[model samples]
Target: MLRGIYISATGLKAGLKQLDTVANNIANINTVGYRADITVNSGFEEKILNYAGKEVGKLEYGVNPDINYLDLSSGKYVPTGRNLDFALVGNGFFVVETPAGLRYTRAGDFQVNRDGYLCLPNGSRVLGEKGPIKIDNEELYVEKDGRIYNKERSRYIDRLRVVEPVDPVALEKVGGNFFVTAANNVRPGNALVLQGYLEQSNVDPNREYPALLESLRYLQSNARGLKVQDELLSKAVNDLGKVR
Candidate 1:
């Protein structure tokens, strides 16, 4: 009875975790450059049950969430026709200087701060080869290779510092569509930059809705199993052991 209760509890926990993951994906469906998380579960090894020093049967403990990985697949490119907007065509992240230190992101919706520096919507300064890109003028052109040139003056400004992680799986999400990792984990990236585009979120509602329903069903099933085990335990301890 106790073993059954333990198994059901584990199943409930795993189901809740899966539900949360799917819900988050659905919530971020409209976010720019959002990457969906995928959860994987692994079952505990079956143990042989013994009674009076003799093998009886094998008992299985329920599964648990093993790990979560980002869906690295690229999202669709959206054209905004704004010069400051940028998007990567391949693997890479745009480097930005945040208050918490340097962070990386795929979001390319950028604006120029009052300090004449190009920055993300959250005010994180966008980094270039020389540091924060100072865009004193709006008439600038960005090349596919990330080079920025002053159109009116016809002078070179700097190249955007696009980078890729040495171990992408080691990167952690820090919210607001940013990712953080050790400085040594990054390397120069080869992704092409589009000057007037943004990447849409990679979440697919069609898949997430079905996953959410399935997780809810699993949770409800586990809850019922747990209640059944508890009632059986109560009956065994109270009614069955009564001295009538």
Candidate 2:
């Protein structure tokens, strides 16, 4: 009876965690270049103690389990023909300058602020080889290689700094579609810019919605088990008390 209670408790915890992930995904359904997270579960390993060349003590599932792992997969690329928009054809990240320093993102929805400086939607300055790419004149163009040039000046000013980390898990997600690196280090990669295309959110609602429902069902089943256990315990206690 005790073991049954414990197993149900673990299931409930896991179900809740999975539900959280699903909720987060749904919340970001329309988020540009948003990637949904998936939870991976692993069962507890049993250990058996041996005494005098024979098994004496047996181990069972742990009282608590820790889950840590979020797989990063590329989301689908959507086309939005906006001059300031861009997207990674392959694996890469666009670098941005935040108050917390340098960060990265897959969102290419960029725009020029009032000061003629290119920036992300949240107003974070987009980093380039020559710092933030600022165009004095309104006339400007971004090359496929991420080079920002002026047709009037006939000069190449700066190049967007795109990077890809060896271990993507090292990156952390910040608000406003920004990602911060663990050590603030960036890996070398292509920084191609598309003048008239925006990247789409990578989350698949069809898949995530079903997963969310499944998690809810699992939680419900666990709750039922817990109720059953409570009733059984109550019955046992009542019988013991009727010792007259």
Clashes found in each candidate (C-alpha, N, C closer than 3 A): 0, 1
List runs of model 2 lying over 4 Å from the truth: 45-71, 136-139, 151-153
Candidate 2 lands at a TM-score of 0.84
Model 1: how far residue 121 lies from native, Å: 0.9
Tens digits of per-residue lDDT, candidate 1, 102-212, equal 999999999999989999988999999999999885667999999999876489999999999899898898898899999899999999999889999999888899999
lDDT per model vs. reference: 0.89, 0.75
Off by over 4 Å in 1: 45-60
Give residue 2's error in model 1 in angstroms.
Answer: 1.2
* Residue range with the least summed lDDT across 10 consecutive positions in model 2: 45-54
TM-score of each: 0.91, 0.84
Best by TM-score: 1
